[model samples]
Target: MRRFAAAFAAMLATCPGLVHAAQPCLTAAEASSLTAYALPSAITGTAKRCVPNLGTNAFLPTGGAELAARYAVRKHQNWPAAKAAFLKMGAKDESSAFLANMPDPSLQQMLDALIEGMVAQQIPLDRCAEIDRVVGLLAPLPAQNTAELLAVMFGLAGKTGKAKNDLFSICES
Candidate 1:
């Protein structure tokens, strides 16, 4: 999970205009929805990008497809709120006009591609083994549980002053 969090934080840091200190925050549910929708693809992309490092027998190379598939089942179900939460994270006044004017389908496509590309690029090869181990540990949990756990951990980080550099905030419940 540390690997996941570190990779996510690195990805967020590279995104321009995401540090909107005063932007409207996502609700806990919205945050969870976004995490649920995005996490599977992130993992899948990481696994694919790290295949050379992970080896054929690594859990990610062997079981990642199944794990990602399990999480994908709820992606459509989570999209609406996830989309809103994603927009909230990215949109920053006139700078985000391009995002605001894009149609939903186009926006979603861009977001999906961006997630895959960013995960593939951000995760360090040196950490692939640790990431593979962490994801394998997480694989036994239900998809929702994994997503919710991540959301809660992020939310707690924001709330407890641990997330000083987080890109966006979670709203108070």
Candidate 2:
């Protein structure tokens, strides 16, 4: 019995997702909203402009859910740190043209998710509002070639099919 208990404990320690599953990063409503959301108009315009620039990256099989999971784990559930890392990953104007085009609602959704994810992770909340303010002020977007950029962002957030389909729909228009 002792050996069996030890092995089970070892497995749990090695698989962070298993632990997270018991404490989901997103609430049922949030998860449903994320999956059900139609591509916003701002992102649609960006996708239309950027799809042609997809190159080989679109073929790469990276799902948004997996990326979110990795991100959730990587930041140890710290909201502010995750926001910084996202911007550093070239989400700023220096790398993404779509940033300039994104609508305020879309941006708000992303910010809300960050805060919610952090809260779900059990991060201390005393500074959350302050962090939100700072992050909003610092966020930037690219001025050109934004389709591929937005696609990557959607893919990372676990909405690859929606991203591709939306871009393709725009191309057809």
Candidate 3:
């Protein structure tokens, strides 16, 4: 939901001149790969942030940890494609050069931290229960499927004119 959309919007908003760029958008696969790479961080961050409100017995504190670990197992495998999508986000802008030049380790760390921070901040205390339920319901999915599902959701959002901007777009399949 709303938290996911807000986090995505916040990320796109950070890149000035990124919306409606002439640069090509990411394919669904690429978006999925990137999402897989970041999903673990997002889960951990959200769990950490919401644990106070949700309590130690909530889905976030218990099941969420296992879910995050499951996603983390695929992160390294997902990194290459994710990195490409990350850099390509601002490909038509001046920041592209900087992004291209950054060492992979540094870039990886930066993105992980950025994603973790964005999700943690975007989720509100009141929504913790809803998020917990959603995470619980989603826990059955394998990591890749979960990532792909999110990519599709975001792609649909982009199609509806909610996700595309000067800086970001999901390519049409």
Candidate 4:
């Protein structure tokens, strides 16, 4: 957990616009703004379908190293196909627009969760690739890029807090 936290801190340091005085959680105004851009039902529905397949074992802490290894392998194998899909989705431009429009910390955390969820699931490599690509594009922008990524991810992962558990399930067989 310390290692993950350290890595996350490092990520924040490298990425500008995300270095704000931390708040404990999202404010009502922030949540309301996020809801305004809520993901379409179709996308959220797909996430719901995918979640169960991840199973209860998906986010176990005991298999962290093994899960990380598997995720690396899956990411390597699927990145190309996923990149093509990302371009097809026109996420590149859309991502840039999202970054320009919204730069909130809550949204950034949402994006991080989404990406982490994708890495955990390791099945929908295409969407994972899209999120990864957008994240890269947002690297130079403000930290909100990360937030937008999470919002999209939440939309993809059923927009529920429970979906975060999927991040720990990566090592499940």
Candidate 5:
């Protein structure tokens, strides 16, 4: 009985603990499951039935990547031009103007949760290739791009925050 108790204790000690509780980073499968529901359009009534037009630069995370390849396409285009591209994909409308240069607080947290969840689940974005393209874009954007975009979404770092350069750090641990 003592041996069994020791073994039981050992097993308990060996259990994965909080380490297992930590979620995996975003991946392709998880992204697919939430794609239809967790979109910005789903959250914002303004974009009903329409993919949120992320302007030319509003993509990467919120819209789920696939833009790098489209970079060449985007180089020849602008905000209105990007909107036209979304239209070709059966997208009908957009949420707002070029949030690319703007930011909102509440929306930013919501977006951050979505992104953190994605990275945790290893889930891809709305599309597989899109995630790839977005990573490519963000990888080069001074590391703070993601954090800045998050602040913009949250309305924290926009015209109000005044911490333009530091916005990238976002206090990410």
Candidate 6:
């Protein structure tokens, strides 16, 4: 029975669902999402996680995710210091180094995730129903050619597809 228990523990260690919360504040998946080519190849796996205090907002930087966003961008220039800065910014304990090594663009995605995560934890994300509306309307348009996307955001008229969905279309005229 003792041997079986030990095997079970070992098995549990490799189980991601169990590890996601029990192991540390951050997850391996979160770590891998960060990629910084500037760092030495060997330092690509050092990261840790942090737990949030309930009923309070902790992750959102004072100026609306600027610190975290900048930290993400810093990977494009320097990463070691940036990682340290991230630590200083209340990231607490980091586990995987993968996040520190991700490129700047990926960091944008990371920041978005972090912001969205904090917001979701703090309030109902459905409050921002417009994002869904935007996605649904924009889905048919070519994302690669962001002219339509930008036009809508900036209230400037641009390209029109064959079937313009008024519910989705942004007419700037």
Question: lDDT for each of the candidates?
Answer: 0.75, 0.29, 0.77, 0.33, 0.29, 0.29
Residue-wise C-alpha lDDT for candidate 4, range 1-173, written one tens digit per residue: 11222233343333344433331233322322332232221123223334344334433222323333433333333333332222222223444345435544444445445544433333353443343333234334332333344434433343355443111111111
Please give each candidate's TM-score.
Answer: 0.83, 0.19, 0.85, 0.24, 0.21, 0.22
Worst 10 residues of 2 by lDDT: 164-173
Model 3 stretches with alpha carbons more than 4 Å out: 15-24, 161-168
- Give the residue spans of candidate 2 off by over 4 A: 1-95, 122-173
**For every candidate structure, what is the RMSD over all alpha carbons to the true structure, in angstroms?**
2.6, 20.8, 2.7, 17.3, 22.1, 21.2
User: How displaced is residue 10 in candidate 3, in Å?
Assistant: 1.9
Model with the higher TM-score, candidate 1 or 3: 3
What are the per-model numbers of colliding residue pairs?
A: 0, 8, 7, 8, 27, 17
Global lDDT of model 1: 0.75
Model 2 / residue 78 / CA error / Å: 22
What's the candidate order when arranged by decreasing TM-score? 3, 1, 4, 6, 5, 2
The TM-score between candidate 6 and the true structure equals 0.22
Native-referenced Cα lDDT, model 6: 0.29
Q: Which stretches of candidate 5 lie over 4 Å from their true place?
A: 1-126, 154-173
What is the descending lDDT order?
Answer: 3, 1, 4, 2, 5, 6
Worst 10 residues of 1 by lDDT: 1-10
lDDT at 122, model 1: 74
The TM-score leader among the candidates is 3
Give candidate 4's error at residue 83 in angstroms: 0.8
The TM-score that candidate 2 achieves is 0.19
Tens digits of per-residue lDDT for model 5, 88-127: 2221223333322234444334433433333323332243
Off by over 4 Å in 4: 1-59, 91-114, 117-173
